[model samples]
Target chain A: MIVIDTWLYGELASYAGEDAQPGFAQLKIELPDGATMQDLLDEIDLPTELRGITFINGNLSAMPGKQHDLTQELKDQDRVALFHLRSMWPYQYRQGAAMLDSFNDEIQKDGDRGIHHAFNG
Target chain B: MWFLRINMKDRTHQLTEVPEKYKKLAGRSLTSNLIADEVPPLAHPLGPNNKLVFSPGFVTGTSAPSSSRISVGGKSPLTGGIKESNAGTPWAWKLGRMRIKALIVEGQPEDKGEFWGLVIGLDKETGQPTLEWFDATEFTGQDAYDVYPMVFKKFEGRRVSVCGIGMASEHAYGNAGVIFEDMSQNPSRFAGRGGLGSVMGSKGLKFILLDDAGAPGVEIADKELFDEGRKKLAAALNEHAITKPKGGLNTYGTAVLVNILNEAGGLPTRNFSRGRFENAAKIAGEAIFDGVKERLGEERYNHACSPGCIIRCSNTWYRKDKSEHVSCVEYESDWAFGANLEIDDLDTISELVKLCNGYGLDTIETGVTLGVAMEAGVLPFGDGEAAIEMVHKMGKGEPIGRILGSGTGTAGKILGVVRTPAVKGQGMPAYEPRAVKGIGITYATSTMGADHTAGYTIAPEILAVMDDLDPLSKEGKIALSRAFQATTAFIDTSGHCLFIAFAILDIASGYQGMIDEVNGVLGTKWTADDILELGTEVLRVERKFNEAAGIGKQADRIPEFMHTEPLPPHNVVFEIDEETLDKVYGEL
Candidate 1:
């Protein structure tokens, strides 16, 4: 079981209880075989457009994907953060995408996806 | 450009040529310079000794895009120090076109509640505006929201822009703000900090209406160069991701900061008792965007608050019955009244915003005040309905309402809230100081007293508009905050909207385009270093005034509670030492 200590937002937060703490809602989850980033999203059940940006272990993994493909493989001990919107600026989105693309390439290249490689924060 | 000086004590007005030393000074720089030179810093903010200065930025009236802001400056009743608050509206553009650089209002009426108004029109002798003051006692008791019809009716046959206060300001609320008519002619846009409106109201001045029927607008020094710079800046704006037509702010409004701050554990919740809100996304930008989409015919998004702003970030909300509720609600306003109060209902928060606008109160200060009131159990946490009810009383000047109107710092003292989230007698903005150390430096060191726009380290720290720095880190924040503050001081004077900084900071051409346009109009060759120098001079002038006002390096402080209390998610206090914080204004 991997630690899924993340809270929902937007419409999903509305469905979550008033006492459903917003950030870092700690819950252990089990991922099935060959589970990708898309699988974790499907299990969480947030809408398509509402999924503005996402970060795994302090590094960006997905964004408002109406204009881009962001599906990636999931790794254990990855602290994932979900959001409904990032910014209106395209460059900010582009830079975030670049960072995530590189992070994913590292996971594939070295087979060691550490938090240090993802983010220092 | 000329300075319009109005003596409220004798009810006389005059237009004077700009002094040689002040030819290049305008907007925030001009306001600060005049206040430092003229107004007695030690004088009571509400007394006759204090002066109110309103001026458009250097590029305000020209064809420069997103450059139509009016700076309102004075010694603040809220912070008891120097202050400059501004807003973008048609009101400022009209001032710029009339070649009126600044409007200085001084002195006070001998009689109590003897309100007055100033009307400006073209002088047949010189083709410039002639200023006149008249009694405006009839509209004294009305709410700002309801005074729009009366203003339009009174100026029925004239082409003028009107701005003033309401019952809150008239009653001398410390958190009061000046109200201006937006593009929709709604009394919406505001110079909404430092209780400057109370200073105006205390002078027995209700409003100033500028009618520019025969005005030729501002003259361009080098029209060709101006156009070139304008084109470059426009291209940079249009091409950029954030400043593009339907970009982040235009789509989500400034409320976009909500989720991002929350994700970073910086969204101040429950009056800074916690770092993040449990229902942040419910009242965030995406939710607002979605709500507007659902109520498309009833509600609309992407409206411009100022006439020439291309990145129309302002939004409008309406009831299901198609009645307009409010046009736009911002991040700080929502966070203060919504998350800080533990009230998640967006519609309810909007209603509260309407009350703040109606009463002419600073929503951030008032919301933080209300949160402090809640901390003392005057109002319950998460009680949206009760919060709205209390808002009505503020304008009415009820006993409890007056306490609320006094601003968050005073309210905290009255309520005995030890953990009050205020610095230098002003409440903090949306970001929690404990969670975001860079902003923490800004909140402590800004001359204007805990104002986010005073420095806005968020661009680099969180939004990544500048080079990415850890929001939670202390390294290089003092220098970063000071540099941004200096740039912001200069930008605030240029009459350009501060949002331009996002594009200018990110795109190299955007920054050059801004400086080139200012120089294009003035026919002066100023490098980027010169702009930074101008910004530094503005801060120096303000710091000088603040020093005389009894605010010095000692006054540069966050709340004691912030220094002790550890905010959750990132369990950190405001750990940046006082010595380093003091160094923020070192070069300036």
Candidate 2:
């Protein structure tokens, strides 16, 4: 088994059950080896639509209306943070920052090169 | 319609008709142009030759939503360059309604130790602007929070608003900010950057009070067109997710960016040594919202900073006993004291913010200076109580307090700290340039030193200015940043809040509405393309002034530490070459 240290922020903190604090919740979930992000979401019972911004080990993996990280496999002892829909990261503030290869590809394929305040997919 | 000039050297004033050249300009464009035309470039920033000018935006005082913005411009004592700092408040709305195009304060009193207040109102019989001078010596060397209410009470029977400086300005601190009264009469709103307040203080001016009773409101040249434009922009503001009622900003405030930037590893922490703070969530907007609910026994949304603002994003922090501690704990202020100092408690951060407000200091500059002081071992990181003591010293004008009050770059040099995060003598804000390259380019090239608002692109259509270029490439990003800077200049001149960019960028009609409103007021035909050109002209004038003042292109480069040190998590250095940095202004 592999352990994943996960953080839930804002309203999504309720997903951690009794471990939830006022603004955030942290949990160490024991996941079977080779489990993917989808499997971890199923374990926490969090719908993909509820997550706005997601990070895996400090690299942006997903944003609102963009959820390419669901199928990405999780690694052992990885740090994952999930934020609710109210969260936002403006394009200028995030431009040229680190992101997953799949996420980068998804952003580049957009018509305006992803120069938007929010993506409502 | 009139340029109200107050000569401090003689304690006299004059009202001149607005020149044809300046009739079309307002806000930043008007202030920068007036300074360029009147003031000598080589004059001392705090000397008699330097002039401080204030002007409202184009649509200000009209029924336009979120239009009560005032731009204050002068040669900066901090950057030693041309500077325009702005804020939104009822004072701006009153000034616009009085039909004063620009209020210019020039010359200096020989007895610099004394201060005087100026009362401005409209004459009931002549329908002309009037000015009255009063002794304000007793109000000097005191907290602005205490002074503001007294001024309001003295003018209790009349409709009035106040603007003044605090102890920071009286001491001639480089981080001093010009304080304006918010809706609640708190001296919380500020034209808070570039040390313009010190310039006012140097002139022996303490406050400027406006009483706009029986004054004419802003005249719209084309009422029908103006109403059409106003409705379009208002509808866009109401419909957008980030700006609508109960939207992200209204619900959580600007501090919502804390966690998002932390997740992206772009949040500058520990004197720019790291990219992420472990305790960021504790001081974030989400935590503020929840913490307030827990303390107050109810859920409270944010309130507007100005009178007509719809996208109310200003938040207040309450004490444990359900009393208000401060009116706002913004993102830059929160990050500067929280992650930058490695202090995460909201109470400590809010206390520091309130102290800066009371002292009339720019919170970003104060916090950044503290971060550098922490790195020098003056105080240890995460020492909240120690930080509070240091801020009190600043308010008291202690020796060490004066050193830190000289701003981030000077404090870094005085304390012998090597890793200073400054550009052109001004401290960088919350964003880490190493992790975010585009903003890095902006920080390097903006006429204003390291300003985040210098290049804010609202809509994708404005990206059309960079036709056929690949935005992913280095050259493409430079072009995009240039276009953004130009469009932002126009928005600043239009007198609308930058938050309107969020809605206008998504809704095309909203963008048109902004232009239409400007045209309706000014009675001119201006298209989207004309906006880019007009904004470009503003930048050109500012660059020319800075160059003549000896802060040429060489001073536009980023700090040496940013280019050498690697930020954590992402571990990226600012790799954009020098030649590319030159292209931001070179192509213009």
Candidate 3:
């Protein structure tokens, strides 16, 4: 199961229940005996441009390709955190091709392949 | 016709006449046009080639209420582009009464001499400008009273206006601003932006004094016509709940917006990362007021930004420990330093305000720069003491300090911060443009660089005066933003306090009648059409300049995060399409 928090601004908050609760929602997943992280993304409705720099318990981890191997080990109690956008400038999305090009090398350096090795085993 | 020309090289001076064409442009319009014409865009901002100018607005000399505005213009060390920032203060009213439309100080001296000041006075009857130079060391570490009276004594009760810089400017720091003494003899008012102080220092001028003793009063074509319009306009404002006597603004000042915006959840925090901050109540208007009342024991918490301002949305803050904090701790500054930096301590924010004031910098830009530095981990977020120390470093012209002082754009580059929240090399104010879509258009399109006050679409879009439109919807926003932008350019050029926009928009004929009064004063026939045209022209000129400067087209954009990170509370992203943004400039 995965949980997400949404904090709206100005007048929009009225739309949420006045109690200001997290308005929790959950998604349940069933994986093949050996599934991968990329498979999890393929199942969700997240924006395509959101990639790079995933944090697990506040510590940045290896690439999605390597992290995907964890899909098999995932259970009902596991937690997943995602950052939709990498760049901070507001208004536009779609990280520039140049930005993505460099980020690929960073993912490899951060041991994305090793994370995949864990799930693959 | 008298003008004083100080040859900075030799510490010598001459008196001259105001050119005919320049007589029309005053305040921001005059100063900006002057800089654009005279200054080469590529010239080093702090070099001798750049000129410094201070001018009052078109209606500044008239007895119209709240018409006093002072404009400062020079090459901006912060933006590396032409910058003009106007501030409202009683000094403008006093100066305007002397019949001085503008003051121009130009050229550096032959010898690289020590710092010197100049005083220019009128000949009482002849109204000719006279120049006197002050000793270089007399004004160091002194307040306006200490230094100003000495210069005024030279004029002998001539009712002069004194414009000078403090120690911060003499060092030629990029963030340095020039202080103008108000009628109350307080030096708190400043023409603070764009490092105009650097331009003054570059010209080797420490001060430019205006003495209008012999000058005639500003001419009005028809007294009856002007008065009728003025009375109606004034009544509209006076009767309004917002602008009237002892209204919300009167009690709380601009700090009133702190709670309202926070309640809306648009109060930015943690360097624009989050929409809400837990510390809003601590630094809110009511809290700020209570703090002052307990500490100062005075009923006078509110003060007018300028003379004749009926809406007193400005205040003097006192530390809880019973010491002077800063006069006029505006809402934007409160958000920029307090909530944005994750520093909820009001006293610390006050200290930062004082630091910017004495050092001669824009509080918004300086605070935003510090926030960007925090984002880069140059300093930890919410380190209020470190922020104050960094500002002090700027006063002394330290290298890292210079980068921070230059503004958020350069600071982000220097520190390698990816979360550089800015538009066109200038920092955004308190409102997260994504939250307020209409204001977002303004942040993208304003020629002055990401300034919210540049064009306020919030009134029409959110407040819903003429039409109640969903703020989240993108329909009619382009037209709304353009209309508001055009109207604001006219308002700024007219030298009227922008808060008046609220009253004017609400009252059917209030805005038009004010325009009529200005026409009556100027001896010209102008209707609403003329005012709108003037605004359009100003925008056109700005767009042309930006296009020529190569910041056009591609430069107008919101950052990538807005599109991807669906802001919390409302899952809505910035729905305004990029194609629509380009259409805004289509007419231009």
Best by lDDT: 2
| Highest DockQ scorer | 2
Stretches > 4 Å off in candidate 3: A1-121, B1-23, B110-114, B137-158, B296-298, B321-323, B457-475, B569-575
Write the number of the candidate with greater DockQ, choosing between 2 and 3. Answer: 2
Candidate with best TM-score: 2
| Candidate 2 lDDT by residue in tens digits, A14-101 | 8999998778888998899999888899999999998888999888888888898999899999989999887777777877888898
Q: Mind giving the per-residue lDDT tens digits that candidate 3 earns over B30-143?
A: 666777777776677777667776766666666666677777777776556666677787666655665666666666766544667666555656766566776656666543
Q: What is the TM-score of each candidate against the true structure?
A: 0.88, 0.98, 0.77
> What count of clashes does model 1 give?
5
> Cα RMSD to native, each candidate?
5.6, 1.2, 13.7
State candidate 2's DockQ: 0.73
Error of 3 at B406 (Å): 1.6
Model 1: residues with Cα > 4 Å off, grouped in runs: A1-53, A56-79, A83-121, B297-299, B457-475
lDDT of 3 by residue, A6-78 (tens): 2221212223344322111124445444444455555553332333223232122322233332333333433
Clashing pairs in 1: A88-B248, A89-B241, A89-B242, A90-B241, B57-B495
Q: Rank candidates, DockQ, best first.
A: 2, 1, 3
Give, for candidate 3 chain B, the lowest lDDT window spanning 10 residues. Answer: B457-466
**lDDT of residue B183 for candidate 1:** 89
